[model samples]
Target: MTESFAAARLPVRLTINPRQRQPPSVDLLAWIHRQPEYRPVVRQAGGGGGRPGFSDAVIIAVLAQGLLPGLFNLLQSWVDQQRTEASIRIQTGDTEVELQVSGRTDSARLLAQATEALRAAREPGPDTARELGAGAAREPGADAVD
Candidate 1:
């Protein structure tokens, strides 16, 4: 008979952005918590409150590696499209950094590459600049006349 083995799973649930339950920030945070270094643990709120919470370290590490970059890119697009405004807010146990995209640029590829690098803490390849140049060439030029 063949034996079937199941992988061990962590027993914890964390909600990153409770207000925007479907936001990408929440997805990124959940993904980040699964990383080997996150080391999350549930804790009771002080004063014996029934609510459970996560370690500040888990929040910080995820913010540093996952949330900030993806947020900057996502928000950049939103702000450039006049869909939202940039706002940075830091609280006692957490920080939020927001950036506004100044001009018309897709920036999808740049954000993807940046998110991947931050997730792995690795440097991007040298050919990234060449690829960026090629992408820029597809846009309409300032001197083009009808």
Candidate 2:
């Protein structure tokens, strides 16, 4: 016998009520909350009438003036931000000797990995820029341009 698994994917449609106040109001939230497309999918995802999975599409539609591309742009911005943060760190060392690595942000996992790499190479260095390689590198002396 063999066992197999399938991933369930659903197309979600979301709509916001225009009659509602332009900025914030009940009619908009209600329209989004009562949209038919999400009901079945939420149920399938183990949510009942009381507890439903708020689909990303619904949230996007509500937040971005119903523009899907806007939602994607926002998400992309966040992703780009994380990647930028993950690259920023200061290094103190000689060109051929040892280097010290230091990052302002306290990401434990990232710090630990940097420490491990430093220890393995027996160098005192912060090679964050070098680690990024040429293609990924931002302009020289540029402070993590957004």
Best by TM-score, which number? 1
Taking the candidates one at a time, how many backbone clashes does each contain?
0, 5
Which one is best on lDDT?
1
**What are the runs in model 2 whose C-alpha is more than 4 Å off?**
1-86, 95-106, 123-146
Ten consecutive residues with minimal summed lDDT in candidate 1?
Answer: 3-12
Candidate 2 residue 55 C-alpha distance from true site, Å: 33
**lDDT tens digits, residues 11-112, model 1?**
212222211212333333344444434534322223322223312222222233223344445434444444322222211122122111233433454344
lDDT of 2 by residue, 1-146 (tens): 22111101112132211211123223222333354543332221122222132221222122211222332233223333333211222221311111111122223333333333323333335564344322222323322222
Cα error of candidate 1 at position 18, Å: 27
